[model samples]
Target: MIEENSLHPETLAITSGRPRNTPDGSINSTISLSSTFHAGGVVGYGRYGNETWTDLESAIAALEGGPTLAFSSGMAAISAVFSILPVGAVVTASNQGYSGVMTLLHTLQASGKIEVRSVDVSNSDEVLAVLPGTALLWLESPTNPTLAIADLPRLISAAKDAGCGVAVDNTFATPLGQKPLVMGADIVVHSVTKYLAGHSDVILGSVTTKDPALFSRLEDARKIGGAIPGPFEAWLALRGIRTFPIRFEKAQANALEIASRLSRHPKVDQVFYSGLASDKFHERASSFMAGFGAVLSFTLHSGVAEAEKVCESSKIITHATSLGGVESLWERRRKWSGESQLVSETLIRLSLGCENVEDLWSDIEQALGNA
Candidate 1:
């Protein structure tokens, strides 16, 4: 068995996936560019089950502390999970879940293959009310754009008792900060496009689970759906993952300071950050997250119009979509999310990067000035 020794994520980022390949034992793991290999019977036919891909899978599985599978994108992983639901199965989810996911559910419901109901994920009562008939409890704590956190442990307990499988979008928190599987969730999904890759170059997704049944179902969906990542992309994601600990730490430090400063800004109306003491998500995050995380949402003093101004006026901050890279990103949430309550007309989403905290804040403070 190939084993890796890692104590901290920073350590893991450097040490993980590195095998002793040289006769004298080299320190780094080599990237295998091979597209196919022998199964000890015949030549491998395609990208499916390639050596490099399998090595990437093994590294990810080891890091997540569960059996993990890679996919083409975060949406692919999510869609693979939805593929498991039987016809007419019901999924109770946060109304604020990712818009793409909500759209996927709606599409399924429209096709008569599934039923999806949206509700406030933070309200235990709201979620529990539908648990009995729910086939899946789709959850996103500190939900997209709104930064609303659900009572994860409570929901997991209730969902299990009701015979509903639970899946948590752990992207916002990243595994560096949160482990939903360890906290009783059946499946943990991530848009590796965000924090996991740490770079914007690769779009990937992952699902980690202890349940073999759930793993088998998702694995089948992955193989049959033909959404597997290329060996090189997987290699890139694995490489990016090694630096996750350090990148995550720096970004989070910047985020906490940014959130603190934003709350006090005269031009800011609302700031949503789990790290904020005043935030609704604070207590839950304090208890559940290893770190408060880097993503945040806030409203400008002037709402939508001001939001557009902030996006365009900033020189250092780029008004763009997407998060979890080495550079700062800013986006008007409402415009991108199509009016879901998760993203308000006045809201701006910021994904803090590895840049100097002082610099990022200076840009934000200045941008908010004219807004």
Candidate 2:
């Protein structure tokens, strides 16, 4: 095998964590389905570990430049991180982050287990103001739905100076786009269900950390909490990751094209995408990431009713919720009850896929025209 560390991310995605030659010289790693192993072994029980899960974790860890632990779902991985916090811990998070994360924080706050403070992570001053005495600073750069980019380096630096740990949700910008550990984040989280498992068939999550202690704690939490991914899901995720590089590249290209068109459309009030030259976060994003990612949002001039009409009128694009699949998806953000109030009713979040740019544009244009 080649030295994966010296190679680029696109190369690493194809080559890393592959099994050595088996007895029959099989290229893919075998999925071990044993529930219990012999006593006194490294993996005594299935809940604790699996060969398939280990292979998947190793592959993702190689990409993230750290050790990784896999979980049943993205929320489970996030819950594992929060499980490490002591009762009454103070956590500062993005005000307009993923709705699921915000709901979890609110639930914990309601139970009095943790105190959550929400802030605009893009504002360096606001982030710095909340960092003092904070146990953890949770970040989601190029935030979901809104596509607002956070000043990660600045926030990470200030958090470190204040003796706080920083965790970045790297699902939007996969390790191929940005390496949070290299940029000084203490932990990086991913929804493997998204880009990592590009087919949208598997539901899994992972967390990677450079710190050995943090990795151990998260692993322990996964084991004790029984939030482990099945062998099949791990195997599927590993398979999906093999083509991530090319899929991401194509999707990002499509997204940039779509965003450019949307910005000039008469029906569009505003387009939010870091990839655009006119975007406020364009410079910062260019400085930090390999690409601006495949997701973008735009507000319709005709408002919420028209947004709904456009979503229904689409022929090629799927009107769905989650993103980062091989097929394009778009939805009105406010359609989800849990979506942030900051996300305007007219805003439609688009998740570009590996579709032809002209075909996608025609579908969108027709939908907009009909609306």
Candidate-wise lDDT, in order:
0.82, 0.92
Flag regions of model 1 displaced more than 4 Å: 1-6, 20-35, 39-43, 337-342
Clashing pairs in 2: none
lDDT of predicted model 2: 0.92
- Give me the displacement of residue 307 in model 1, in angstroms: 0.6
**For residues 1-371, could you state the per-residue lDDT of candidate 1 as single tens digits?**
53453355566566656664678875645566665565674436543555555655666666666888888899999999998889999999888778888888888999998998899998999889889889999999768878888889889988988888999998888877777887788999888888878888988888889999889888878878988887778778878887888888999999999999999988888999989999987988898778888888888768678899998888777789888987888888778644486466888888888998888877887887877
lDDT (Cα) of model 1: 0.82
Candidate 2, residues 93-196, lDDT tens digits: the string is: 98899999999999999999999999988888888987887999999987998999898887888788899999999999988788889989999999999999
Q: Point to the candidate with the largest TM-score.
A: 2
**Lowest summed-lDDT stretch of 10 residues in model 1?**
41-50
TM-score of 1: 0.93
Error of 1 at 67 (Å): 0.9
Query: How many steric clashes does model 2 contain?
Result: 0
| Model 2 spans > 4 angstroms off | none
